[model samples]
Target: MMVSRRETLRLAALGTAAILASHPVAASAASKVRIGVLRFGTVSWELDTLKEHKFDATNGIDLEVVYFAGEDATNVAILAGAIDMIVTDWLWVSRQRSDGGDLTLAPYSTAVGAIMVKEASLIRTIADLKGKKIGVAGGALDKSWLLIQALARRDHGLDLPATSDVVFAAPPLISEKAIQGELDAVLNFWHFCARLEANGFRRLIGAEDAEKALGASGPVSALGYVFHDKWANENPDAVRGFLKASAQAKDLLARSDEEWLRLAPIVRAEGKELAKLRDRYREGIPRRPVAEEAADAGRLYRVLAVIGGEKLVGSTPEMAPGTFWQEPPK
Candidate 1:
């Protein structure tokens, strides 16, 4: 369910106090603060921690969570003044900033997402892709696929076409179509990758390749928390307390698997697919941000521009100033 703006602030303030009582290390707060959160695979950890009482009942701001199909959808919530903050990809956030949205980037979340394919398929490498139909997500599949191809062309010496035999579908259907063999392969983020693996599919390549050894950021790992800059500036104390409690949550997730498992249902939604999504995230997409990743934000913006230009028409994605919030201090 979507959280209204008033309720978001109220709950955030309550959650902040709750976190303080438990940790006692967070910044002091005078009143409650609220945050509206988007629902997506990348920010799933923040959602989990928030839902798990990790942010409630203490010295932290209370977080009210809302699920969205994608960052763009969450952008709607932000525009409505319904959400105070968001955790999403830098690409969409940049676009929002360009749109004159008053949002600020606070911290990096996950990095590049990944691409997956079945082992039984003939698609073996980037060069092997040509006529195969690929399933993609949320109307951005073609753009994402083109982004992958751009990297292959720029760094790996591969030739790609202006278009492909890719199939566009929503998140839930893409995996199912790929599994049913209706599509050659589905390019997706990690949750689907893990689910496919559990169901016997082989990974093609993923954003995890960004481990400093792959000559690339690998698979796009940075996801960051976003919020209204105007609101955040007025609530610096709220921001500090929220991040403080979130830091604890990050540490907790890093050190405990049982805790993650317990919150899986709330985060991913219980079922076979949800189980696979939970496991997929566990294998990759760490709960903490890669602090140094702040440098790569510009590169991500440019890459997105190029792919969106050729693959999308009508308008170009915008890059916003102060779109990414500066990395928090260690």
Candidate 2:
């Protein structure tokens, strides 16, 4: 269930107050980092692993997790100086920097959405989508939808939004409509797409494939850990430790089936659904060098700017410099 915007703000305020009260020395403590996370986000899996194995302590930092009801709430928390970091996309970080904010991104996940249809559906190609009733999860400017549009235009010269009837709604609503047969297809978030796959849906095209078709060198992380530049500079060791701990957690989850089994209750999956979720999560772990990832992101950003226009990329003709954070030399 989703909370109202006002309620979410209230929760963020309370969460922030509690964090400050509990950590009176937070400002001076070089070994502490507070991260604002969505209550049900996949990030919890990594954080859970980090805590379960005491990875934070091993890396010499005190990790704090504050829950937010909505993405906007997390943004609000970070902007108001209530938290040190949050998970978000590079585009948003770029927009902030363009507007003179100092936010930067560290790669989090490369998993992207897919266009899904019922297993028996006849929509086997982009051309087949013409005249179909399509459900889009994140509205017109969604990165996945924009990428699909770019793919359609580049490969088949089809204008997806103009050719198909599109219904824009929340991810959950889009999933429900797709399951009910009201939509011929859906472009939804990765996790929802995974669930649909477990229940018999087929992927017609994945966003990562679309990216490759359009010009990305490889899979690019669409989301990442975002933090202020000044804060990171002030606590370099803490930031590096947190990132190290995050990588360790991902390595553990990638190699250990036993860990996933223990996380089953938290992920709320079983059998095929559990397997699908695990595999998808592992596929998203970032492995490319930071420079390579940044270059790919810059190319994709230009494509998005061209296709999505001012609405998606704002007034920035290119991604802002330092949008992807690079660790200082050891």
**TM-score, every prediction:** 0.73, 0.93
RMSDs, each prediction?
Answer: 7.7, 3.5
Candidate lDDT values, in order: 0.57, 0.88
- What is the clash count of model 1? 39
Per-residue lDDT value at 246 in model 1 = 71
lDDT of 2 by residue, 1-330 (tens): 222334545666766676556545456577998898988888998999999999999999999888878887787677657789999888888887887778899999999999999999999998899999999987788888998999888888899989999999999999999999999999999999999999989999999998888788888998999999999989999899999999999999999988999999999998899899999999999999988889998998999999988877777899999999998877
TM-score of 1: 0.73
State the lDDT at 158 in candidate 2: 94
- Total clashes in model 2, counting residue pairs 3 or more apart in sequence or in different chains: 0
Clashing pairs in 2: none
**lDDT tens digits, residues 99-185, model 1?**
455666766445344566777777887666666677777455243455676766766576544345766677679988878888777
Candidate 1 CA-lDDT value: 0.57
Specify the highest-lDDT model's number.
2
